[model samples]
Target: MKKSVNKTITIRDIALSCQVSPSTVSNILSGKRQVNSAAGKKVLAYAEKIGYQKIHQQRFKKAIHLILFRKHKLILCDTPVFSALVTALDNCCKAQGYALSLSYIDALTLGEKATQKTISQIISDPTTPILLLATEMSEQDFHLFENAKAPIMVIGNLLPKVPFNIIDTDNFEAGRIAVQHLIDKGHTHIGIISSSVPFDSAKKRKQGALYALQEHDFPIKAEDILYLSPFAEETSDNMTQVIQNRKEQFPTAFFAINDYLALGAMHALIQHGFSIPKDISLIGMDNMPFDCLVSPKLSTIEAPIEETARQAVLRLIALTQETEQYIMKSYMGVKLVERDSVLDLNTCK
Candidate 1:
């Protein structure tokens, strides 16, 4: 430690040795200017030999709390995807010497307080960062973020258009590819069942599906896309109607927005007297945990949840290193998983 200070060289030393102002030497350290190519290189080499570190205030605070703000809606987080994402994010946070805390926004049953806590309540400190797993942010939520002055990075499509970085999956491409795969398989009539509403991901996936149909010259009428209640009980009517209305139209293939949607549609298809693959081939997204165990395994799109989580953690960490408003974003890739649910045209009518 004494040697570090003993040999300690200041920018002043370099400026004097190089016959330049201290500011010129400082600029060289910050890499701000090209101070005469040869002369700049000399100052940089001297600085490195002396070992100088730009001491900014102490590193940003420690742990960042990840607040998942959905009080009334509980989605299972036990699957491999969710598990992997959570684990990766946790691991990244730990490795960075940061603590990760998870709190359910709705669990407090904070009601209006829940909303208030989300937007207005942020632990104030310049030391660390806050990683908000707010996959879906509404207009009100935007106002919440707008009012805060914390280091924040959201996990999904941002609502308020705040400059905090966002890390999300490419839902649109996932949807487009799922539909494109079905089209390539020689299925002309394709159907879609959207699991939820106003979910930017859900909407983008639907748009991708439409893009596939449009590209393939297939019909995509308003009735063709079904936006049903995501809850099981509320899905019965809409799923039944979709299966009934499209059966004869030979809507031989369908794309469920997610594994759960496919599962529900599978139930409805069975109740409506249709056999998987034989009567209707299906492809879903998220490749949910049980997709392969069903009567006919489901073919679906895989999401890089762990990678998504890891990226989110990394971006948030990077955000803490600066105060500039920038767009830090990343999208993981998607691939098709072939399973028993798809009917091969060579053997099927």
Candidate 2:
């Protein structure tokens, strides 16, 4: 251990020795950054060895607790798209000198009766802000936020007329963009593969699809729209049947709510002896990493994941700092990425 008569061992000194920025060293010392786990560990060990002073006490209390709704915790953690959003949120928090912690509440395991305890545990620190996320959480469940002492901001679900702050993509607009692309390509026969569950995002996207069809004066047929359970194992076969039943009348293009559903639809289309973009063009939402790796390279609506994450953190900070009285709901824009999966009918002709 380096014995030091000096009590003022600066953050820059530690940063220089560690070959990282002073902000990074500070973030590591204050438990704000964890994305680069190895770097934090190395910095910690080095600091301890050099007898670094405890400077974290002088830092501002910028802790943020991220809680996933019990109903969709597994999906948020396990899925690549949702997991990437969570990671982006984490890194954003760290970059701004805010400590971010993930709080897990298992509603399935503990049952609905234990909700009070869950809320109590989540708001244990009154000063720390809370960021809640869920794929399909209801307003009734969101009422739990009223009891939390910390300022709250929700991600993904934006309840209409609610006072709570929200940061999410314009899913309805994204849906419109996806369908309009097919329409612009001269595809009159368009299909939508939607989730069986009544998720707001999926519902909004479907509505957007309907609006696009109406705007373009295209006939909306009931047989062209298909609903399948996102979690079901038999989706591949069901998707096949949904198209096979239509047979020669099947839509020449499809819009899926997400990449997972798009991949499923792709597999089913291929199984039914259909060539992608040759027989049918497919597009999905959420530009997940796997979208590039798949055959034909998925055409998708790319949500501003990193920007949304940064905005959420900044809004939370503004609210906590009293710079903003009410944090308004914000929607980030999305763009369609044209790829091999979508075909231009004019060119094909």
Candidate 3:
């Protein structure tokens, strides 16, 4: 037998070898459409064996990139709600026949050079769409996406001024519902334990709380509201000092911006010899897992974390496929998850 030299195998050659149409092979390679898993595997394996170089040149070739734009160390992995969103995004990507790549844009310390580098890599390939986990992103942080080529969608509680597609929970409504629950319990005097963090969700929650107070004709006392540091230990210490200092003016009930802050306030109040829902009533938002694990199960507002993630991914896909145009600002609803943490003031007397 005579020796034969290897020739360059084109997509048509691969398609012919796999006994599938060239379009099917191209679709499989580009991740443009879902093909039979066995057929896809066969094509991929054969292409790899023949040393496919075209696919290697592509960036984000057949995947969705999840960029976590955070200003703090507590990125998506640190918080349970964010974790749920990530999980949902992963599942959604898998279902859509796309691989998901995760990257972090630490806007907290993002310099010009680094920002340009990240933007370059993102726009390097127009086929790969970007799904931004921008829940914590500010208006300035969103400017990074101004020159991006790939389709982008944001998942968070608030939308930035830039008109990109966004899917977020209705934090304002969550705040309103939380405070209304306390009001329904006949707590005319209520406090909101908040932090100085510049989170949109936190701000909306505060606005909602104030709205509820105004609706019920309850006096909004500056003395009743307590502001603490964002850090857990600092929050705990500040809450303790505030509670002790304002003991005489303490409100009958307290609503925390989130479960963590709520937990901090609860611990401090208890340390100051005030029992939860006994000497003081408490409620929180975020429906964090700790809410259920605590000594007194915490009542909280459930943020639509997973649903927002799923919707964001779906919207991103739609954008990439050109099935939808015009940026959309979508809001997911929130619900009150009542547990043992709240006290019905009517029953107390």
Candidate 4:
């Protein structure tokens, strides 16, 4: 017996089998030109039956450029969240017949003249679709890309006023859910550990936590909210100082804006001889891998990072294919991941 090689299926072969012109087959397959309904249906059915592979034309394929706009070194770094998002976007692009490219704009060190030049160079290519990773960007920083001619979408941040397609995690809802969980656990007195850097996501999470507290008729104290440095070490130091100053009074539970801050707070609590969930319950957002690896583990809100990236890529591709461009704002939902960090006061009783 001899081994046989499978033959490649082509549009020409499909057209010959269907007894139609190659141009008619090509037009029917691509949907660029209209063909007779009966002929189109027959050609499509035969093509499917024979397993005809439709190759995307090189000229029609577009590149998606992901611009990682880093205004500071705090939020957007070499972390698992960032890595997962990038990987998801790459996978989506490959599946959608588009090439993906990455660029970094570090405004922290880039001078004004150089930054403007870089922005100009990026926006110069009108053919390529752009997806901005604007996690650390401010409204002032977004003005740089406002005038671009390319089809642009923003990821990881929400700019309500700026008209562009956006895909971001629902930070506000995540914060509310975290606080509500603590409240349901009979924690009326709760504290929020927020970033001092004033990222939009952090601000929204803080607002949502505050809103949840207020809705529960809980008294909001000025000292209960603590703003720590974005760096984990600095956050730990600041938390330790806060703990020392308020030795007599501490909230039964604390909600950190992100896992980084939560871990830092956990270290400070442990150092100060406070037991997790026994003396103080805690929760955080952005369910990083370290959440599970920690001693008591961390209860957190899982940001839909992979889903956000996938949706952003799909939407960006859609925008590129559209004749009339329209702005779309999409908010991906977050999930509450229950772990060992939270203690239920209701069960204790």
All-Cα superposition RMSD per candidate:
16.7, 7.2, 11.7, 13.2
Residue pairs clashing in model 1 are: 60-127, 60-128, 61-127, 61-128, 71-106
Using Cα atoms with residue i matched to residue i, what is each candidate's TM-score against the true structure?
0.74, 0.80, 0.79, 0.82
lDDT of 4 by residue, 1-349 (tens): 9999876554457767887654355446645345568878899888767655343344226667878887778888766677667667766776787756677777878877788889988888888889898989887778888878788989967878877788888889999999999999999899999998989999999999999999999987889899989887798998999988884588999999999999999999999899998999999998898789998999999977767778898888788779988888978888899999999999888
Global CA lDDT computed for model 2: 0.78
| Arranged by TM-score, best first | 4, 2, 3, 1
Candidate 1 lDDT over 147-214, as tens digits, reads: 45567777866433556677777788889999988887788889888865456678878888989898
- Residues 127-209, candidate 2: write the lDDT tens digits: 88988875567777776667777788888878786568898889899999999999999899898999876777898899998
Q: Which candidate do you rate higher for lDDT, 1 or 3?
A: 3
Total clashing pairs for each candidate: 5, 0, 0, 0
* lDDT at 196, model 1: 51
Root-mean-square deviation of Cα positions for candidate 2 versus the true structure, in angstroms: 7.2
User: 1-349, model 3: which lDDT tens digit per residue?
Assistant: 9899866455557877998655455556655445568888899888888776444444224688777666765433455665556656766676667766667666558777786686677767787888877767777767768777888887774565777888888889988999999999989999888876667878888999999999988988888777877786677898887866764768888999888889888888888888888878888988887788887899999977767777888889889878557889988999999999888978867
| Candidate with better TM-score, 2 vs 3 | 2
lDDT at 211, model 1: 90
Candidate number with greatest lDDT = 4
